[model samples]
Target chain A: MIEDKNQQRTNLSELGEFGLIKHLTKNFEINQPSTFKGIGDDAAVLDFKDKKAVISTDLLIEGVHFDLAYMPLKHLGYKSVVVNLSDIYAMNAKPTQITVSVAVSNRFPLEALEELFDGITLAAKEYTIDVIGGDTTSSQKGLIISITAIGEAEESELVYRNGAKSNDLLVVTGDIGSAYMGLQVLEREKQVFQVNPNNQPDLDAYTYIIERQLKPEARKDIRTLLHALEVKPTSMIDISDGLSSEIIHICKQSEVGCNLYEDKLPLDPQLINVCEEFNIDSTTVAINGGEDYELLFTISMDDYDKIKGNPNFTVIGHMTPESEGIHLVTRANTKIPLKARGWNALNG
Target chain B: MIEDKNQQRTNLSELGEFGLIKHLTKNFEINQPSTFKGIGDDAAVLDFKDKKAVISTDLLIEGVHFDLAYMPLKHLGYKSVVVNLSDIYAMNAKPTQITVSVAVSNRFPLEALEELFDGITLAAKEYTIDVIGGDTTSSQKGLIISITAIGEAEESELVYRNGAKSNDLLVVTGDIGSAYMGLQVLEREKQVFQVNPNNQPDLDAYTYIIERQLKPEARKDIRTLLHALEVKPTSMIDISDGLSSEIIHICKQSEVGCNLYEDKLPLDPQLINVCEEFNIDSTTVAINGGEDYELLFTISMDDYDKIKGNPNFTVIGHMTPESEGIHLVTRANTKIPLKARGWNALNG
Candidate 1:
């Protein structure tokens, strides 16, 4: 479904390794005070002063992580960076710099790479993070993107996944399940178009969910809001592999059980409607759906008053004793054990 | 030419993502004081205090960067980590942590991955670095490795490639051209084996150069030796892409020209023998052939006494004014303009 535009294609070999890297990263401006030198050298240098540096990396492979049929090159680049930044935010750290390494086959043109860099630059500008250093190389097959994000935070402000107490409240920022439903919509349209090539599917109604899949933003605001309210989370994680999987990670690390209230699970109206239209359960989609770059955290009981009625967060669960086990209380009053059916690439 | 042995093949899907990561990295001990947390977290937290963080990343594709016909999986993993560490050492920094992201097709078994991780863990131990974090996913083709190395150094001790003066002396650690010759030997053996499958090529004489190609070490000792002698380099870079290409980078970035003495270029005895056997010029091999992983740097005239006649280093060139242009002065008293004929992946 991805049409190769019959444009002037410039071979990547015209520009050597150094020339290609320079051409792609020429417009990235260094705005972070922590960054001393960015690109052009053997490595990027950063002076973090007294702040603790946090580093996270993610690898996205073509065919496995994304299909080019529906995913635009620019949005793929933006989402690749966002995915790594979300990990840094999960650590309660402010991302300062990122190094992007991409390997592409010869089928791609110079113009395609330029479009990818355009999206990368846009994300760097929006996040106020400097593009520090990266490697550009040739692949034998499809494209592979590996991004490493570097961030900083004071020792006192840093949160880990092993600090939740038994009575702490579990909270999540923004809505869930939209990104997964968005993927379903796009996939369905792809199959439909495969059978009928001239079909012009109306995608206006799926704009919000599709955007969630294509250009999801890392929760950079939650860190600021928690700081403004003087409430530090006891434990935190990014909902990348779905809410159930992330909850299991937090619980396994913190040595506590949780009771997630199904009725309190936040969902966008569009997502609810899409699930019904597709004959899928909204709760199952919300619990098992992946690629939702939202922040999930647990705060102590004393900090509940500060966040109780806050619109930026929803208290969906509470940590219980380890013996209680992890369960989800259905709206019908039956409690069932939660399962982490998150997307696993290795399973394929 | 790579043979798949009929052995116990454990499918990757049986372990899942987290289980596989944990199984692979369980033996990685956090020995660096700067690494506050390693693995099992959203991001690895590092405390470098006042030291500047030096970051470098490299991407290696299977067929484009390496061939599995002669290169073993374990050696590939070891070389991947060493390559990134070379960049960190080029900046005159001490590497403390590394994140390794690997993408492989389903053909590889768990045992094969364990062998690769064995080499990675060995390099981590030898270099005194912690395996902080990484991402493992499925690839559509052969293996792809992306490694990011993090190091630290004081502001005064850190070196850049743009600090060389007109009168600075260029120095390189260890002999060059061995890795390149090693590849030639392997390729020759591979060709012979392809023609006659049972041809047993004697490789005892090529052990040194073969090891240089298979398991190269970054110049970790060079930083310590310079620190002990109190001689800081004005400019530094690793010799991953041959001496001539690296010299061009230093001269161009430093806004100076270089006159490299052909007779003074270091060469291993084995490399010289192999070059003669192949009927190739040793000097050409040393200048144009790549992947040596040595440290090439420049020092001020005042510090020449500290480095002169040092067995570990060789002073092969001196910097000139920018208008002079980079050149190589041969033993025959002919000056030839230098060209960066480094390895270019996109050329394929």
Candidate 2:
């Protein structure tokens, strides 16, 4: 990454903190009337009118959360912003603005920072969210990205994880395990590259899974389509910790149990092939592999008729009384008690 | 730290994401009515009756912001929360709530986390701000702390850095340079201890300065006292970036000039004594030393009479015409142009 040298560059100290802020944010027009004031005071002022606000925050570290070798700065920056937006979408709200703060070490050149900001600016444009305000400082080790996204929605349309009741149908958006399989594929190729840097990564066939991990999209459209169809989920949570883990969260919070069918667990063909090649059970991967970025929700049984056959969603299970406990029906007709073994299995 | 037998014994995977949140926040109580929902939903919900709300955030890294070797987890936790609250005070608003999210490695024992939360709980009690919501995940490396503080104030009551006018007097709360001296002392002692662990550090004389570094207080009282005395700052910013940089910020933002007097610079006696011992200039430390966490502001000439001899403040300078630029009248009876070395000066 080469620094931009054509324009006259001013040292940050030349303008001081306040001047630097004003200079950098000069062109940042506040399109949202909700932004009462931005970047002139100790904090930005927000006005949401009568609508309630949905707030979510996420932290992404350089070495821990991502690797600069394979992960492009643009993609890393884009993913960091999208991750927080997914949380807002999960709440069924329209993300309007965000505050992005970065802590970086001197090891990164100024050109590297520009690349990072390029991705951030691109994502901000795509999301139609104004970059309101944030603090930037130096870190001791790697770069740290912390984002706080603010969204808005009517009080009645909001969703919570504790709203599920007995007999509600569980549904999942898109497919599961692709992102996890993608991660595996990347790691294997990385090892291959480490052993021989000249080895070309055979990523053409693994495009679908790799894209899942590198650029997973938020289910913001799912919320819009459901609203258009007049179907509200009884309870919903994003599939970040895998389907089994998220399902357990809904069940525990809603005071209900569930029985998911192993045959109905959705999987991409490429992902299944990759899992098979790795000698891991495809079912285990679907149930436990994380970072899917899909939506897992529970809808009332009466409303299930609206989209039971919809190509975009899959009906996997139904909630039962809490005392019954959660279970999984296998293809062999044997029932297994569902315990949250997603991440714990990997750790042990 | 030692590991806690009871709490430390449970694995994070056992609780998963949702369960971990519920288990950790079980002891936390919601004291602010504006905090409609917290922790369980995809996003936290905030409902405020006021027309506008103030939001601010900060990130504290492991080594750059703090040293784990000497700084205890409890103080780190306290300092993180206070830093956000200080920003709210700078806006002349009372902090009502905060969302704290942290990521740390498994190297930390359960007792260490408890000690960290112990300080958070204590700060909540002292500041009367609710710990509303947060996200927690396993970090790959060191500890990372991100806090977003929300406060309420009328549009007219809020202060802006652009509000300063010519002839306004620049004032700072408490003293400066002590925190910088404290850091030097701690660093020196750390080097000594590293050479011989068995040797005891005779630090009784440097106790005050060390505490100033380890546990700096935000100028929360200054805002309240200013309100009580019926004096409002024309423009304000917290002094986390040293006095020289802060003065430059006010001048640049307000489009005015300033003239500071070297004799008027405030310094704790211990800071002066230690600076002398270290063969360092106390004025340099006062001008460029950071992490003071004090309030720096300008007041109009009309209100100057009310705050002239106040023990809690020092009028270090006065605003001048924009063409005059910022100047420092040296003790040698010469006017010298002021330069803000800022945080970037560390490289020199």
Candidate 3:
């Protein structure tokens, strides 16, 4: 984190609520043809025509969902959009518009909000989405953000979490556990900085993991890639809460069971090295670590040949009958029952 | 507010996040045919087909938007949904679905949330809306609620705030200033109770005004009535931020000035009586007190004969050329420039 001690502070009340919203959103350009009207209206109008509309929402609160000690306002803004958009991609849809609402205390200045919106505008540009509408208000405590993402897709191309069959192959996109490890690294650095303000710790070795934690990208390209391969997933879900927890969701909703192979869980080399340095089990982190923003889905056994050598995909497991129950097949040929050890915000 | 001193308390972590969501939303039925899939997948699917979709969102924070001492959780839940739906109705659209997301601290028991959801369910039933999806998690401080309402309308029937033309009559639905007076009464009672816990003051006279504050209704019936009368509003907005602020929004966006008559401002009998008791100006409260949830719109002067003596509608003003500027015509035949003095949450 870069701290600027000489930054100028502008009071939010000087501009009022309307002036603040107008100033913050003045640079956001609407590029979606479906968004007939955006901002400046009581409600946004969208003409999805023949396509089906898909909607998802999330609420992120300070101290519970994130800590400002290590999280920059810009990255928090970018990651907030990514997390919501990840759900749209998990459903085989293209996101076209989003509504962003934020509540902050007077401890924040106008420049801080501008930096947050800069990241939002950047994400909207990168993902080709329109910033349709939002509400800005004051919080009695820390900052709170709520986002609602809207997307559209043809009826035939849509996917849900209840279509998996017994013989389907479970697949995961990209690597897992990297984001969780990145958070650990940041936490450690935060502790070090707290003990000694003059100490400047070198973070060159943690660049990748830290970036993964801060700027994790959503798998927006997976839908197009799967479309080109002619492989439509039977059941799909985003890996927001670790691999084992997501597998459980698919199995329970589809009325089937799954056997996940520990050896098949994709892990980046840096994540493995970091886990060793931290003296934590790599397999345990891979199975229970969350915030990967990757797609986890089950496809028909017949489609294995189509994705056999795809670098972006890893065949992690297979589905079984509902009577068998869910289990994890370790590399040592041991079967252990899987449990949902994903991060629980409420438990905190 | 009703307080149960010996109410049973169940820890939220006992059910976990998923179980808590399932238990809370189990009673929400999908009444709209447009909702293809709800609450079980990464996103909810809606088939709008050929009709245009209208979406609006709002964020409510404790201490800033409401006071828990004077507002019950159930009433809070119902009012949260009503505020969002009011925006959709302002566009002359039929609200069909809503997604509610809430963040609360662990101090709130599961039963407290159940009471909140009971209010939400009742509002959903009354408005014929489907609670499609939402996210529930922990907050670090007070409660936070975010809601997004989705509706549908034909292209010709949809309204915006920038469609008002010169010579259009400014019309308001029902009455105003009652909800604000209701809040004043509640606040006074709360203070009185704090000074003497055993004192139980009679509140029979303020029932209507109190209900106006606790459980305001959106204008869902106005659309059907307007359709039956073969009339469409030129421009429309909901009165959440009081009348003066809303009028400024219309005049600035539509590029038309307005002359609001002081004599024609709507005021209920209870609101007048309460204003006298509190020694506050009724006209000032009518124009600057927010959260009324009524519809304000502009209609062509030619349609004046169509709604001349209608009991539900009141014509308070008419639009003029932009050069004339916006003003309030007083009973003394004095023209004073209008200002936006509506409640600013951020300014708090």
- lDDT, each prediction: 0.92, 0.80, 0.91
Model 3 residue B196 lDDT?
Answer: 88
Model 1: which residue pairs collide?
none
Candidate 1: how many backbone clashes? 0
Local accuracy of candidate 3 as per-residue lDDT tens digits, B1-348: 445452799999999999999999999999998898988899999988888999999999999999888788899999999999999999999999999999999889999899899999999999999999989999988899999999999999999999999999999999998998899899999889899888887889999999999999998999998888888999999999899999999999999999999999999988999999998878888888888999999999888888889888999999999999998898897998888973443134
**TM-scores for chain A over all candidates:** 0.97, 0.91, 0.97
> Per-residue lDDT for B41-102 in model 2, tens only?
77888887665778898888887688876777788888888889888888887787888888
TM-score of the second chain in each model? 0.96, 0.93, 0.97
Task: Sort the candidates on lDDT, descending order.
Answer: 1, 3, 2
Poorest lDDT segment (10 consecutive residues) of candidate 3 chain A: A339-348
Index of the highest-TM-score prediction = 3
Q: Could you give the DockQ of candidate 2? A: 0.57
Model 3 agreement with the true structure over A1-348: per-residue lDDT tens digits = 444342889999999999999999998899999998999989999999999999999999999888888888888889999999999999999999999999999999999898888888889999999999999999999999999999999999999999999989999999999899999998898888889877787888878888888899999999999999999999999998888889999999999999999999999999999999998888888888899999999999999999999999999999999999999999998998888864442133
How far out, in Å, is residue B247 in model 1? 0.4
**What TM-score do all the candidates reach, one by one?**
0.97, 0.91, 0.98
DockQ-superior candidate, 1 or 2: 1
* Model 1 per-residue lDDT tens digits across residues B1-348: 344353788999899889999999998999999999999889999999989999999999999889888888888889999999999999999999999999989988998888889889999999999999999999999988999999999999889999999999999999999999999999999999999988778999999999999889888999999999999999999989888999999999999999999999999999999999998788888887889999999999999999888999999999999999999999998998988983342122
Candidate 1, residues A1-348: lDDT per residue as tens digits?
A: 444463888899899788999999998999999999999899999999999999999999999999888888889889999999999999999999999998989998898898789889999999999999999999999889999999999999999999998989999999999999999999999999899988888988889999999889999999999999999999999999999999999999999999999999999999999999998889888988999999999999899999988998999999999889999999998998987873442123
Sort by DockQ, best first. 3, 1, 2
- Candidate 2: segments with Cα more than 4 A from true spot: A1-29, A341-348, B1-26, B342-348
Residue A91, model 3, lDDT:
94
